[model samples]
Target chain A: MVWLLVLIPLLLAVAAVLIPSGRLRPWLVPFGGLIQVVLVVFAISSENVSGFQGWLLLDPLGKLVLLFISVLFFICSLYVPGYLSLRAERPTRLFCACLLSMLGMMTLMTLSHHLGLMWVAMEATTLASAPLLLFNSSTRSLEATWKYLLIGSVGIALALLGSFFLAYASLYEGLESTLQFDDLIKLAPHLSKPWLHAAFVLLLVGYGTKMGLAPMHTWKPDAYGEAPGLVGALLAGGVTSCAFLAILRFYSLCVASGEAAFAREIFIFSGILSMVVAAVFMIRQRDFKRMLAYSSVEHMGILVLGIGVGGLATYGALLHLLTNGLTKGVLFLSAGNIHRAFGSKLTDDVRGAIRRVPMSGALFLAGFLAITGSPPFGPFISEFTILNGAIGSGKFVVAALFLLLLAIVFVGMGSTVLRVTQGTPSTPATATDFRESPRFVIPILLFLGMSLLLGLYIPPQLESLLKNAALFVENGV
Target chain B: MYQLIDPILVAVLLLNFAALGASQLRTVIHAIALQGVLLGVLVVVAHNEFTIWAVLMACAAITLKGIFIPRLLFHAIREVSIRREVEPIIGFIASLLLGGLGTALAVLFSNTLPIAQEHVGSLIVPAALSTTLTGFLILTTRVKAITQVVGYLVLENGIFIFGMLLVEAMPFLVEIGVLLDLFVAIFVMGIIINRISREFSTVSTRNLSSLKE
Candidate 1:
């Protein structure tokens, strides 16, 4: 059953490539997305979904990430047909094929129970997404794609080496070396401590690079700023979350091995560092899309910070994953609309977006507020929970620092958001004929609606699932 | 069989330096391809027994890294009309010095991690680390897009050398996946380099700087 999750998208990806019509190729994306969402829904509801001789299994953590990726892909898919039709001059063959393959690879990453398998799936996602970044075929987009591919590949290479180190840790102990996640956790204590520590650092840096954490996040602004809004949202939201899941897998091993203290300190430090970096770059930012990229860096910081704080904070981090991913979708999709309507991503040329395309403009404002942790939004609840968890754990310094950075990000991000949303348009909307069509407008609304819904209420099942995942990570089930 | 490993490993390390020092793009790619072939040979020699899995992995590595990938890159250069010179950001002497420094550091660094008893005397760990670092130096110091790709391949070679230590532990599927991913990455990168040259009328990364903050 779990194999189908990966297989369906892969098959659809082949069909997307074979299909002759440029118009019809893109529909495969939404079709593949819908099937994935359905499969994930069933996988979530059912128990013990395992396949491929136990190589793939949808665990609690996997379930949450799978849900986010599938639903996010679905919503993004709804806008694809509309988005592609607008650019009829360009062929959709590569774009559609890559998107579906990426979905398949992401699904495989989540379902992978073995570490090597996870690394492969993660690398596949990077390869699959590179072409998507070059969709515009502009010089700037080409540059962005190059940076993303090279940096991402180097980071993943480190991760591959790290996996080898992990296997060697056991091999050094004269035990049968294996990389099955469950087996590693079982053998954690007996594995060489130095090797484990080294492995953890490499994995963090490698996966963290993919997650767009600080010091390694140089590619984020460029890639996110140059890529289309939909691609940016997926990279920021979907692909980044899968990378986080990879980190969590290793972190869970550290916890099981009783090396939580060592791992936790590093997490807290890097997490705080990422937020500070985001805050610095976001201030006085001319490009609104680039500012959102920084904003993503900030939220990724928050997620890791929550995990580092532990206990209730881990749960907060888990919840923040969902909230942040969905909120980014809202921002990117609406931001895409605004970018199209205004024909520019810079603040100087993109003012009074609210007037130019009222519906997308308002959604953009709401998304900005939600992402900054304004009340009545999903991010507010999640961010506050992380704060409460930090305070509860008596990590007063981390809590204070978290709040300070959040405030700085809010203020920095707010100035640019307002500049884009407020004031009169410096140039008229004649630059691009893109208007607020229902196809594009509806998905952004649905994403915003989901973010709002998640804030107001945590349905019983979701709360339990989040709790189970948090517990599963805190102490192995 | 194990006694022959060190000499070949040392050759691989020398190729790393050769790649670092070579200013010509053709020489650098050839040096990397030779390194890839040596690593592929090292794959079979590193293991105690010549198992089918080891043989298969070695063949694949040689074919993809040594022949197919280099052929693709050469075609890219030929088609795109890229100049032969690497056009490095730093001088060749400095890059060679850095490669030397990186090799020393890798040797020093590998001593900290305890190797298994059988593998303790082997130079695999140190050689792997040094190759990876050299790859990094090339990747960072080189300005041409093609040179950067060569750097990336070298970096991957370093990891592949490291993987030879655990050839038995890693599944065949993953090994193939890694090779396939590397092939596709270079293939995709080759296409992008072609486009970069066509669009900008030059393949130099100086043209790629307009997307900055």
Candidate 2:
């Protein structure tokens, strides 16, 4: 059953490539996405689903991430036919194939219980997502794709070394070395402390690079800015969530080994550093898409900060994982529509977006509010939960810093969002014929609605799942 | 293990320095390819006993890293019609000096990490670290897109050298997956390099600077 989740998407990808018509290829995405959501629903409800000799399994943590990715991908998939139709001049074969393969790889990454298999899956996701970044085929998009491939590959390579270090940590203790997550956790306490520490640093930098954490986050802005909005949404929402899940897996190993304190300090430092970096860049940003990238960096920081604070914060981080992902879906898709409607993504030329495209414009403004931690939006609840956890854990300075950064990001991002959404068009007519359509508008609306609902209420099943995931990370269930 | 592995590891380390000091992209690419071949040999010799798995991995590593990827890069450079000589942000002399310093640092760093009893006295860990550091140096310092890819290869080689310490621990499927990913990554990079040259009229990353904050 678990294998089917991975196999189905891959097969769909093959089907996408084999089918010739550009018009038909786009529909396969939503079909694959729908299948993914259904499979995830079943997988989550079942007990102890394992695949490939138990190299892949859905734990509580995996389930949360898998569910978020499925739902996000499905929503974004709904926007694909509309998006491809708008860009009918460009080829859809590569775009369709890469998107589906990326979904397959993200699923594999989430389900991977073995660290090596997980690394392979993670690297595959980078490869799979690279071509999607190149969909625009412009010089800038080319540059973005180049940087993404290089930086992502190098980061993932370091992650491989880190995985080796982890395996060696066990070997150094004279134990039969294995990268099975369960075995690593069981052997956690006895593993060599120095190697374990080194492995964590390497893995942190490695996976952190993937998650667009600061310093290594140099690739995020360019990739997100140049990639199509749908790709940006998936990259920000689906791919980063998988990487965050990878980090959580390791964080769990550290907890099992009683090194959570050591790990938490680094997480606190990195989490704060990422947020500060994102906040600094978000201020007066010209490119709305790039601004969204910075916002992603900031949110990634918050997620890690929540985890760093631990206890209730871990739960907050887990919940933020889902909220931030869905909210990004809304932000990027609507922003994409604005870019298309105006034939520009820069504020100088993209004014009066609301006048240009009413539905997406309002959705864009609403997404900005939701993402900036405004009440009645998902991020507010999750961000507040994290702050509460920080304060509850007695980290007053971190709590203060968290609030300060969020406020800064809100103001900085708000100015950009408002400028794009509120003003009159600089020119009455733009180059693109793009306008508000149900296919494009509805997905963003759906994502935004989910974000709002999450903010207002937590379904009982989701609440329990979040609690189990939080506990799983803290105590290594 | 030490007698056979040490020489190959040492050659691999020297190639790291060669790649750092070399100005010609062709020389750098060859240095990387040679290092790949050497690491391929290291995979076989690092083990105490010969096994079919080691041979298969070595073949895949050599064919992909040594033969196939270099050919692809060579084709890219030719098609892009770029200069063979690469301009480094850091001078050759400085990069060579840094490479030497890195080798020393790597040795010191390896001494800090506890080695297993069976792997005692092997040069694999230090060699891996220095090669990785050298790759980072070249990757960061070089201006040309092709040279940067070469740097990434060096970086991956360093990690592969480190992998030799626990060869048996890595499953065959994962090993193949890693190689397949490296192949596909370079392949995609090759296409992007061509596109970059076509769009910007140069393979140097200097032309890729428009998207900065």
Task: List interface RMSDs for the candidates, in order.
Answer: 2.3, 2.3
Q: How displaced is residue A342 in candidate 2, in Å?
A: 0.6
lDDT of 1 by residue, A1-477 (tens): 778999999899899889888867878899999999998998899979998776898889999899989999999999899999998777688888899999999999999999878988998899889888888988888888888988888888888888888888888888766778888889988889999999999999999999999989989999999889999989999999999999999999999888999999999999999999999999999999899899999989999999999998898899899999899998998989998988889998898988988998889999999999999998899889999999998999999999898888889988999999998888866878887879988989889999999999999999998999998899866
Error of 1 at A210 (Å): 1.1
The alpha-carbon deviation from the true structure for residue B188 of candidate 2, after best TM-score superposition, in angstroms, is 6.2
Worst 10 residues of 2 chain A by lDDT: A427-436
DockQ, model 2, C-alpha based: 0.59
Q: List residue ranges in candidate 2 displaced over 4 A.
A: B171-193
DockQ of each: 0.60, 0.59
Residue-level lDDT tens digits of model 2 in A197-247: 999999999999999999899999999999999999999998899889999
